[model samples]
Target: MPAAVVDAALIVAAVLDAMLMAEADRPYAVVSTTVAALALAVRRRLPYLVFALTLPATAVSSAVVAGAVALYTVAANTRNRRTLAVCAVIYSVSCAATVGNHDLPAPTRVDLLVSVGYNIATAAAAMFLGQLVQARRDLQQRLAEIHQVREHEQQLVAQTVLAQERAQLAREMHDVVSHQVSLITIQAGALQVNTNDPDARTTAQTIRDLSVRTLDELRHMVTVLRASGTAPTELTPQPTLAGLSQMIANSGIETRLDGDLPTDVSAAAQRAIYRTVQEALTNIRKHAPGATATIRVRHDGDTIEVVITNTPATRPTVPLPGAQHGLIGLRERAELLGGTLTAGPTSGDGYRVQLRFPATTQ
Candidate 1:
């Protein structure tokens, strides 16, 4: 219906009810009806408070029409189930009491019966309407909660994807750079002792040639990673137990390899050991570039252990941002493999990193 039509209908109802029913002529009845109508204006804003304020006046005046409307408003608008239920019971009881108290003659019987029927119909209809309102509100709330949970799950998936991408990039860089740097380290050590011989010039040229090739490979790898639809290269082969001795020798660190290595250690356990060695060497290069270092790998039956210790360099090393992140990452990896990693300054005036892993195939 149009707004004008609705307003006109309501005005007509109020006027006709006031005029036709002599009971509305009473001051209490007129006042109660006006108050109830005004109370309904705020039903959506303060439903329970409005109902409480209007109900007693309605009951005292026996304004069944106004009281029933207020009860319906309370039932439909408030989320408080207990309050609505209590209002419903009160309205029902007051209606029954008001009807019983009326002493009517034969002429009034029809009016009384009509009033009772209207009350019963309005009560039933209002309760059903209130239930519909409550159901709609509950459904909206549930949908909002579900949407939030799905959004949170999506954010978590995005973060995981980003982290995996970073790790893959790091692996690619390591493969290319480690090989070239290894050549530099080998040639530099060779030059420290070999002062004579024309063959030294040939060896230096060989190192430079290998480094150029490695740089070309690195450029190709980076280009492949950036271009759309290019399939990523196979993951870099993770270092294993066999690479430990080579790593120590290449690092120019004095390392003692003793005791038997568990041949049946889990892949996770082996990876942890490799990462521990890699991080220790990187830290040494950055902090104690020319310091003497020692690394030990041993298996004591049920456990595999690796320990790396380096002497302090003569000059103080500047700390770098996220230097601790390496140790933290190494520790987390160790714990995941049912092992432990500890890295910090040692009492012997240098840094030390230790990793211990369970030597079990499972």
Candidate 2:
């Protein structure tokens, strides 16, 4: 819009200067003015061409307005230093021609000096304004590019911080959980050998088995967290529904297992299911010891569901220190596998943890 306005103004100035101010004959004035005015319309698109056309017209009939406008447009639009040099040469030649016009009366040295100084000043001002506009536009473009680069760098910093935090968390879990589970396994092994009753021996063995498996998984998780590349060859395979029975038996809570579970779920879905059940059992042991729990796994078309519920604790016991991040971690795991988890108090006097996942067929 501003370019259109500039073109209109330049055309009008050219026409008025030729009609009112030109001392040339009517034919030469008309021709020069028309050519100069028409050239201004294409100044933005073809600034060089417009400047070339107006230079000759200005020289022939003193159409200074059109030539000045053309030079300004070329300088403002063209980044090439050579184009500016050419404009300075053309302007100098036109000013020399104006000063040396033989038809005009001979001037005194003082008057000639004043005219030359004024012409130089006017040409310098036009060029300076054009250069100023161009410089401002260039600075704005550079600032915009810098802002985009800053935003990208900030995103990279955020991701780096998050990765570092995750690695630190994995190390802490290994140090804490691995030590506790190892103690349990050692005690359970001792109990199994010392116990006289067959049922007591069996329960102790189950505890030992579960503790060993949990330790394996804990070690694998620590390795994964610490590793920046592919997993180590010694890393244990992830647990699935096949190991669900061992988890329930070792839970030490009287848990009733039901439902026909599928064996061919995706590895990610399997990990989510296993972790959900493990967290539920751990919570039961921590908050509701000696509670009667039910473990239900169901397979419907395109979906698999697992629900673990425990009745109220019979004996009140001292609560142990807990970070209370188990359910939060489980929710993250479930969502990663395109699954959902809901854990809360049951309708009755109990707690329930439910998990659902999209199933993969064999």
Candidate 3:
């Protein structure tokens, strides 16, 4: 829109210059101004060629409007400082030539001075306005680049936060759901041994096998959550209270068991109990290799309590490094089942873990 307006103004100026030259009886003034104005229309697209054409018309006529427009276009479009300088010098020379050849009966010193001053002022103003426009365009481009960089950085931060949240959810799901699946596996094994009918035994064995496979898949999911590539060569189902005796027998450390375990407790409560015991025994094995441990389970009507304690290590080996979220996972499990778990050093030179759950509730 601005370019069209500029072109229209240049044509109007050319017509005015032609009328003035006709009154002064200058030769071929209309033809020279018409050619200069036509060249102005293509100044932005072919700045150097338009500028060169304007010099010849400027030398033949006294009007400088078309030449001034061509100079501004050259300065605004050209990025090279040396090229702009050369165009400015050439345009200044054309303006001087137009002033020297002005039609007058007998030009005086004051007339010449006035013509020279007007030509210099007009050329300087056109160059200054063109440079101002170029500076504004450069500033706008830099601001756009800065905005894009900030937008990209914000996207990266959002993606990182999303990944961390997913990993945390994966850990919570593994801790809570894996316990219930272990209970199902244990019950199926027991049913297979106790049933006498051939069909009943076969169903029980199938259930047990499926449960084991589910546990393997769960372990693989947990490994993915932790961002580790290594998988267990022989996946094993998690242990429960039914297998507590066998676990103790396998451990080389001396251990004792006490309290009456309830078979009628809710599955949620049973899971919380099993996790607390498992985490406690693991801590003992990792931190105190030769420690003597004791396990206790008690039913007091509405609530069930389980406690596992281990003496200070008699031959403490180098403590194995672990994920260190065992106790944290156990506490989360207990709380989800409306229970509480506590673990710390006891007053008797040992570590103790205790869990209490409402026996009748999920």
State how far residue 361 of model 1 sits from its true place (Å). Answer: 7.7
- Listed in order, each prediction's TM-score against the native is 0.53, 0.55, 0.57
Across residues 154-186, which tens digit of lDDT does each residue of candidate 3 receive?
Answer: 997676666655555555545545545655655
What clash pairs does model 1 have? none
lDDT of 1 at 339: 83
Order of quality (lDDT): 2, 3, 1
After TM-score superposition, the amount by which residue 51's alpha carbon in candidate 3 deviates from its true location, in angstroms, is: 1.2
- Give lDDT: candidate 3, residue 150: 89
| Model 3 stretches astray by more than 4 angstroms | 2-24, 105-111, 194-207, 219-362
Evaluate all candidate structures by whole-model CA lDDT and list the values in order.
0.61, 0.72, 0.70
Greater-lDDT candidate between 2 and 3 = 2
Give per-candidate clash totals. 0, 0, 0
- Give the TM-score ranking, best first: 3, 2, 1
Off by over 4 Å in 1: 1-73, 80-118, 160-237, 245-256, 280-295, 308-328, 342-353
